[model samples]
Target: MAKKNSNDNGKTFTTQQGLNSYIKGICDIMRRSNCAGALQYVPELSWLLFLKILDDTEQREAEEAEAVGDSFADSIPEPYRWRDWANPQGNRRLNLQMGQMGQFLPFVNEEVIPYLKSLKNKPQATPRQKIISEVISSVERVRIDTETNLLDILDKIHEIDYIDPTHIFPISQVYEGLLLKMGEKNNDGGQFFTPREVIRAMVKAITPQVGETIYDPCCGTGGFLAQSYEYIRDFLADDITPEQLKTIKLKTFYGREKENLIYPIALANLVLHGIDYPHLWHGNTLNREVIYGDLFQDAPPQFDIILTNPPFGGKEHRTVQAQFAYKTSATQVLFLQHVIDSLKPGGRCGIVLDEGVLFRTNENAFVQSKRKLLNDCNLWCIVSLPAGTFVAAGGGVKANILFFTKGKPTEKIWYYDLSDVKVTKRKPLMMNHFQEFLELLPNREDSERSWTVTREEIEAKNFDLKAVNLNTKVDEDKSTAKELLDFIEEKGKEVALTLSVLRKWER
Candidate 1:
C-alpha cells in the first residue's frame, strides 16, 4: 500500500486547521466538565479523552461506510481502529482494546498521583486510580466533531507522535514541564512556566558542555537540562560517538520532581527529547531525607553544573540536622548552599532566586555565605529579571540569577540592569531581551546592561545585590506620571495609524 499524502488526502493529521479545532474541542470539554484540573494532573483524562474522540470518529465513519455499503472501517489505523472496542455491548473486547491505551495512561497517572495524595516521592495508586477512572469517563463524555474537527486535531497531535522514537518531541512535553513551573511558582496551577525564551536564554548563558554532568535540584520539567542539551549540541556541535549517542539519546541528563504528580511527565519529557542520563527522581529537595543534613550523602554523584529555577518565597523552613554545611533563613538560601556543595571546586552554578537572599539584614549566616561567595568564589554576575517575568506566581517578588564559580574569588562581579525588561507573550515585552544582554556581555569588562562590581562596593551598602547599589548609571531613568501618560498617548496614536495603514493595505 502507498503511504498517504496529508495534503492530497486532506485526511491525514498535522494540518493547522485540524489542530485548532481539536484543541478547541478538548479545551471546551475540559471547561464544560469544570475538571480542567484533571487535564492538569490526570493522565487518564488525556488518554481516554483521546480515545473517546478517536472511537467516536471511528464509529461515525463505520456508520457512514455501512450506509453506503463501502465498509472501509477495517482500513483504519491502530489508534483509530477502536470501533469494535468502544462497543457498550462487547465489554470484553472493549476492555481488551482499552487495555493497550490504558498502559500508556497508567504511566501518566503515576506522575500526577503524588500531588493528589500529598505524599512526595511515594506512589498512591488505589485512590489515584479511582480518581483517574472517574475523570477519564467524564472527559470521555465530551464529544469530538466527527465530520471535520476530529481530522484536524488528530492531524495536529499526530505530527509529533508522543511515542515515536524518530521524532523530536510534542506539546505533551510542554504540558508536563509546565506543571513543574506551576510547582516552582507555587501558583494555583501552571501560572509560572518559564517563557520558552527565558529557558533558551538561561541555557545559552549556562553553556552546558556535552557529557558534562548537570543537575537542577529543583528541576522543574527538566527545562534547564533539556534546553542545555539542545543548545550545546546545536551550537557547539559536540561530537557524540556511536556509543555516546546511545547514552546521550536515552539517559537522564538531570533530575526533577513535582509533588510526584509530574515525575513521569518529566521522565517522559526526557525520553521524548533523547536525554537518558541524570534520571529524574521523585522527592522534595528540601525534605530531611533529600536536602537536609549532608546533601552529599543524600544526593549522591555530585554534578559539574547546577542550573535551576528553585521555588520562590515560602515558609518551608525547618531546623534541619547537619544537612547543610552552611546556614540561611529561607529554603532558597539552603538550596544555594546545597547547589554550591554539590559542585566540584571548579564547578559553575547558575540559579534564579528571590531578591531577599541578595540583601537580608537579619540573616547573619546568609550574609556570611554571601561573603564566602564573594571572597572565596568567582561571583561573576547577577541579572535582574523583570517583575512580570513571573507575573502569574511570584508576580511582585523581584528575581535575579546568581552566576558564579565554586573555586576562588575572581576579581570583579558583573551586574546587568534588566529590571526594566517587560515580560509578556507578545512583541515588546518578551524574555528575548536576555539574549540582547548576552550579546552585550563582556568577557572581562563592562558593556551595556553589563557592569563590573566588587566586594568593596557591595559591602559599602551592607552587602546588597540589588541593581541600585552597583549600577548607578540608570539612576535617572524613572518615569513620571505625565511622561508615562504622554508615552501611552503617543503609542495609542501609533497603533491607530498602523491599523489604518493595515486596512488600506488589505483593500
Candidate 2:
C-alpha cells in the first residue's frame, strides 16, 4: 500500500510517497539501452512527467470548467491532453515501443495537439502541431500513470509546492535528483544538476522582473528558466496593484533550446509556473531549423533579461559557419555569443561559467574579443562559488556567476568571493553560502566579502574575468587549533579506554 500524508490545507500526498522508489525508477529507466548517459535518460523522465502533469491538469480543469459553466477549458487549451495525442487517428503505436515512435515523429500530431488546435483562444496550437511527433510519444510511454503504477508514488510531489513560484527548488529538486543520478551514470551528465540554492542566488542577483524575455541556450533540466519565472512571480506579487498583476501575467516570456528531450520539459516547467504556451519555443539557438527558423540567417528576438547556467567542461568542439562577434569554444563561447546576440539593447544577463573561460591565454584574440564584448556590455558583477559547493557530483571544478547589462562600456565590475569554504550542511549539495553572499551583495562594497575593480585592473591581467581579486576571509589559526586539539582528545580517550580494557583482561 502507498504511504499517505495529509497537508494542513487538506491536500493529500499520494504519488511521491516513497522518494527512494522514484529515484530508482528514474535511474532504471534512464539506463535502459539508451546508448547515452543519464543526461539523455533523465530528460526522458522530465518529458514524461511533463505530459502526465499536463494530462492530469487538463482532466481536472475540464471537470472544473464544466461544473462552473465556464469555458476555461475551451480558452485555456490543453497542451498535453494524452488521449488527443496518443489515441489519435491512424497514429497508433500498436506493437512498437516508445523509443521507435519518439525517434520517428516527436511532438507533432499527438492527442494534445488536437485539443490545443481546437482551443477557442490562442493561435499557438497550429504551429505547435507542426513540431515533431516523437516528443509526444517519448513523453507518453514514460507516463507516470496506471501502466507505471507510480501514481501514489508521486503524491508526495504535491506537498512540494511546485505551483508556488516562490518554492522553485521543490519542483527543481524533483529534476535535480534525476540529473544527479544521470551524472553518476555518465561523466557528462553532471552539468544538469545546478544546486537550487546556487540557482536561487544567481536569479536573485539577476533580479528578473515581470514581462521580461528570458533565454537559456543550454537549458539543462530547465532550472534557470523555471526559477526566473518564479522570481518574477514573487517580485510582482509584492506591492503591486491588481492592474499591474494583469500586465505581469500577460507579459511576453520565452526560452530556446536544441535539446529535443529538454524542450518539452522546459515548456512544461514554464506553463506550470503560469506562463502561456506560446512563450516557449524549441530550436537550436545555434543552428537554423524549419520550426525555430534560422537564428544565424535572421536576427534573433532580443530578450530583456537572460538567466542561464550554460553547459560546461566538455571536450567536443563545435564548428561555426561565420566569424562570431566573440571568440572561444563551441559550448562556452557559442553560448556567450548567443546570449549576447539574443539580448535587447538594455537587457541584463547572469550565467554560470567554468574558470577556464576566465583566464585562458591560449586564445589571446578570443580573450581580447571577450574583453571588448564585456566592456561594450557593461559587465556588472561576478560571484566566485566555493569548490566543495559542487564536490559531490565530481568535477571539483571551480565556477562563477557573471552578471552584466547590454550595450554599455563597463567602467568597473563588482566581485564577490565565497569559494574554498565549507557551507554548513547536514547533507551534501545543500550549500547556504548563497544566503550569506546575498546578505552582503546590497552594499556591493563589503571589504570582507566583495570588491569593485576598474576596467584597467581587469585589463592588467589581460582581461581574465575570474573573481579571485575580491576580498576574502580565511581562518587558518582556528583550523590548526581545532584539528590538533580534536586529534589529541580522540587519541587520549582511546589510550585510556585501551588501558582499562587490558586491566580487566589481566584480572
Candidate 3:
C-alpha cells in the first residue's frame, strides 16, 4: 500500500534488481558498522521494514477512505507514525538533525519503541493490527547500538516506497533473500529458513489446489504455506472466480510454529507474500492429539494438503510425547504421527525427514512410526538428499523428502538418491538439482538413481527403508567402517571380561 505525496518521485524502483541492490547496500552498511553477522542484522532490519510497510499501508487506507467520502483516521497516533518521526522532512521529525546524534538514542529506545509496544490499535482494531502490536512488542531493537548507524539505516529504509500491488511480489523475494543470507550465515536460522527452492519443489509435487485447505503443522517461517499459496494461485489465476480467490486469500494456508521469535517471522513471511491475515498460530503444534478444536479453537479440520520440514533431532518433552500411539521424544517421529492424523482422506503431503527415522533398529518407536507411515499412508516416493545438505547446522545426517497420500496402504515405495551430488553451504542445494527427480516422480519410474520396493520387502527388513541404492554395486571384500567399529567394540568387551576373570583367579 502507498500514498502519493509531494515528494512522490513517481520513480518506481519496482524490479528485483533494485531491491537486491538496496538489500546488499544496507547489509554492507550494517556489516561495516558493528552490526556484524546476519543474526545481529536481520531482526532489527525486519522490524524497520515492517514499520515502514505499516505506515505506508495506513496512508493508502487513508487515501482510500477520502476517495469513498468516508472520514479517515490513522492506526498509529501523530508524531509517532513513520512519516512524522522517521521522516526528516515531515511535521514531527525526531529530535536529531538530519545526520546529528542528539537525543536520538533516547527518542527511539525510550519513546518510539515504547510507544509501539504500548499501542493497542484499539477497541475495533483489526486482527491484523493486533498482530502488528504483538510482533512489535516482542521485537527488541537489535543492532541500533550507534546513533549514526541507526539514523543511516532508517534513512535508507525511507528510500523504498513500494508495498502496493505491483511491487510487493518481487519485494517479497528481497525479504526471503535476506532470510536466505541469515540461513547461510547461521545454520540455526535454517530451522526457520528451509531453502525456498526445496520448498517450491515440494509445493509443485503436492499440487495444492486453490479451494483446498493447505497446512504446515511444524511451520517455521511459514515457508511451505507461502509457496503453496503462490503455486495454487498461479495454477488457477486464469479460471478462478472472485469467490474462489476470496477463499484462497482468506482461508487457504494455515500453520503452527513453536518459537515466538520464529512465529512472528512466519506470519510476516506469509503476509509479505500476499497471504494477508494468515492463520498461523504461535505455539507448539504437538500440544494435543488433535490440534484444531483443543489447542487452537480458530483452526480448521484435517487439511487437504500438508507440507513441512519439521525440525530435525529436536526432542520433545515426554509429557508432550505421551499423546502419540508410538510415543517418543523425537520431534520428527511425533510430527510424522501428527501429519498422518492431520491429513484428510485422499490428502497428499510432502515432508522432510532425517535418515535415522528411515532405519533405527535400536528405537522401536522409530520402527513403529515408519510402519504406521507405510501401513496407513501411501508413501509413494522418497528422494534421498546428500548428507551435506544440512551439514552447516550440524545436520550431517542424510535426509529425504517423502511424498505420500492418506487413506491407502503403501504397496510400493520409490527411492531416489541425490547422495552423489555435493550440497555444501558454499554450494547449496537448488531446484535444478531436483529436475531429473521431478520428471521421474509422476511416473514413479525406476532409473539409475531411482528404484522401487514393495511393502512386503520393507516389512521383511523390519520396516528399515534405508535400503542400499540399487544403482551402486555392493562391496563384498571388507566390512564397512561402522561394521568394523562394531566388531572392535564387541572384541574389546570380550577382552575386558577375560581380564576380570584372570584378576579374580589371581586374587
The parts of candidate 2 lying over 4 Å away from their true place are 1-11, 14-48, 63-176, 238-251, 272-278, 289-300, 314-323, 392-394, 423-431, 469-474, 477-507
After TM-score superposition, the amount by which residue 268's alpha carbon in candidate 3 deviates from its true location, in angstroms, is 2.1
371-437 per-residue lDDT for model 3 (tens digits): 8888889999888877666644324456788999998999999888887675655666888988998
Give model 3 RMSD, 1 decimal.
7.7
Q: Tell me the tens digit of each residue's lDDT in model 2 across 1-507.
A: 111112333232235544446445554544543414555555555544555444445555566676767654323232333333332211233222244534313343344444443442334533333222323423433332232223222333322322223333344455566556555555444355466677788888878776566666666556777677667766766687766555443444555565655565555555445444424445655544435431212224687888776665542223542445543443565677777777899998888776666766556544865776676698888888764454445334567788889988898888888765543223343446566667776777656777888889888888887777434554555557786786456445434533442343221
- The most accurate candidate by TM-score is 3
List model 1 lDDT by residue over 312-383, tens digit each.
553344355146656443667777777777777787888887667776655566676677677756878888
Of the two candidates 1 and 3, the one with more favorable TM-score, higher being better, is 3
Q: Candidates' lDDT values, in order?
A: 0.52, 0.55, 0.73
Tell me how far the alpha carbon of residue 161 in candidate 2 is from the true structure, in angstroms, after superposition.
13
Among these predictions, the greatest lDDT belongs to: 3
> Looking at model 1, which ten-residue stretch has the lowest summed lDDT?
2-11
Evaluated at residue 280, the lDDT of candidate 2 is 47
lDDT of 2: 0.55
Question: Each candidate: RMSD to true structure?
Answer: 12.5, 12.1, 7.7
TM-score of each: 0.65, 0.68, 0.84
